[model samples]
Target chain A: MAPKTAPSSGTSNSFQSLLKSYIETTSSRLKLIDVFLLFLMLSGIIQFAYCILVTNFPFNAFLAGFGSCVGQFVLTASLRSQVNPANRAEFKDVSPERAFADFALGSIVLHFFVYNFLG
Target chain B: MNLVLRLSSALLAAAVVHAASLSIQNPQFKITAPDASQLRSESLSLAEKPEALSLGPSDVLKLTFQVVESEERKGVQPHQTFLRFYDEATGEEGVQPVRVTPGGKAKFELNMARPPTSLPPTTSDPLKVSLILGSSTHSPVQYELFDLYVPASQPPPAHPDEVAFAPRPEITHTFRPEQRIPAKAVSAFFALFVFWPWIVLLGFWFEIGPRVPHLFSPHILPFTASLAAFEILLFWYWVDLHLGQILLYGGILAVPTALAGKQALAKTSEWRLGRK
Candidate 1:
């Protein structure tokens, strides 16, 4: 049992190394997406921190700030889905143009509601 | 010219109507003099004639004196002779005598001057005078003698011809107790719903659900539910107590809770992928 565990452990370490290398070697587009997601996430975090620090008196402002971050995330996710080779099953017929249109529509609707909420 | 004629005609009609109404409402009168014995009794009590000599209706008298001084100066004698005003309505008598200045100038500091006790020879009917005078008989004495015509003081008109309208008073409003709870609940619910999508998308962007697996792992369901609960508690405490303090406390709790949620979600997502 110990000899079997040793081989399995070594394989697991190698697998982890391979996964790390694959992530590192990913195209610049994927890296850009990662960076964009990080930017959006951090913006949202800062907004939440602001909401916590400042009284939520201007809740509409908070909503707008937070909503923009959400908008970015949704748009990025849609971009990822449309561009990813692995996501072909879901987005086989959808073009980047169509994805962008969906993102734009969704963002418009979100911002409209957010604007109303802010007031 | 036509407009001017119309305006003038309207004004004339209004004046005529007013005059007719005034004549129709003319006041009636009565006369009754006090007993002569009562007047004598009142006069004997004081050295000079009472400063204010109150005379009633139908009261009459005769004055015959040769004034070496001018006629104007004769009437100006201080408190020498004057008619005292008496308000029957109040029964309050004048406190000062009415003096007739020699120059026919009459003044009363505190009361109306007494009318002259004499009537001119030219008049046969007895009449009373309501006169007020002041001191300094430096000029010819000139007496102002007029009949006392005390009309019955009519009470204020029952209804004024012109009514003055006043603005109605404003009604104060107060909120009911039962309504407060639902209002607060609705507000909290709305606040959560409005911000829900934003927070969710923010979570996705941060990769919070993928990074922290232990605290928020297993599912995003519990974290979402916990947040909802926290929001409810926060709103309730805020509504029930000092909002500032509640918010301060909420902020303190939010920091750790948010971090925990992020870590849990991240760890959970990572673990799932790792397992796959």
Candidate 2:
């Protein structure tokens, strides 16, 4: 508004480069985590929409579906934090193997309760 | 269980009526069908029982009846005619009255708004409806039997017969929601079985996922105790929802959402339950 400047090509290219490099540097484990998280999130959102549309006729079924999403979110978020290089300093004392084990155990325990609630 | 009893009783009543038919005939049906069957030489039967009829949702039957005036019986007591869906000993059902016009002709309609639920295809259970002509409570001037059948293809029957019954033994005042649910203690006990995994998860989640007490640790006692206490709270909550709290199924829906709150707290620690 001040000067009507139209010279932004250089900054836009730099932004694109920044995004590409960040994506390129991210580990496959973290990418896998992203994919899984996205899956859970999208599925959860779809199920929520269906719940709204059907008005939760089968409450157990609705709960189970929603629980899967949230339960997966808990497990996957932990996995993401552990694998993320930027967050490496926080969990430095915890090895990746140990972190994976925790995620696995947590997932099993969550699903166990989730299945019971579903019934 | 009541349905079984009603059916059995109806069958027994039908058997009794069939046994009585060989020797005795009620006078009420004397004019219904003048020559119901071509067996007048064998027996003076005025009306024959309707054949086993198979009825569906859309079927409507037009049945004819006549009230004959004979010189042999100069003045007989006029009887009121009604189509009873089933014999009284069998169960309580609808009684459709047949209107006799001044011309001495009467018509009865056997109609179904929806297919019967009780009648099975191979069922020999007589539809055993009674067409009774009577003015007194226990005495009938005449009576007739009509039978029908139902198939499973039809939607569950409308107005399945119901029998009036009394409790075997009286009990004390019944109050509270749990009374409505049978075996309250057993259901509550099994709920504890479900609590083990759920409580562990809650404990883990309550600790914010970073730290977790071992499943058998005393540290998780408070979590389990709180959850167990809340189990009763959950039942009462459902009772409230079902007890005219919401419109239609809204109560049923609130149950899972309310229960999900536990999981939500476990997964996100939105409300803390203090981790060990």
Top TM-score hit: 2
> Lowest summed-lDDT stretch of 10 residues in model 2 chain A?
A1-10
Candidate 1, residue B212: lDDT: 29
Candidate 1 residue lDDT tens string, B65-143: 2222322233223434454434444433333344344433433221112332232211212233333323232221233
List model 1 lDDT by residue over A1-119, tens digit each: 99999989999999999878866776555555666676677678767765675445566777877887888687787787786656758886874444544554465445445544554
Q: Would candidate 1 be rated incorrect, acceptable, medium or high by CAPRI criteria?
A: incorrect
Assess each model's interface with DockQ, reporting 2 decimals per model: 0.02, 0.03
Q: Which of the numbered candidates is closest to the native, going by highest lDDT?
A: 2
Cα deviation of B11, candidate 1, in Å: 53
lDDT of each: 0.48, 0.51
Instruction: Report the CAPRI category for model 2.
Output: incorrect
DockQ measured for candidate 2: 0.03
Q: Give the 10-residue window scoring lowest on summed lDDT in candidate 2 chain B.
A: B32-41
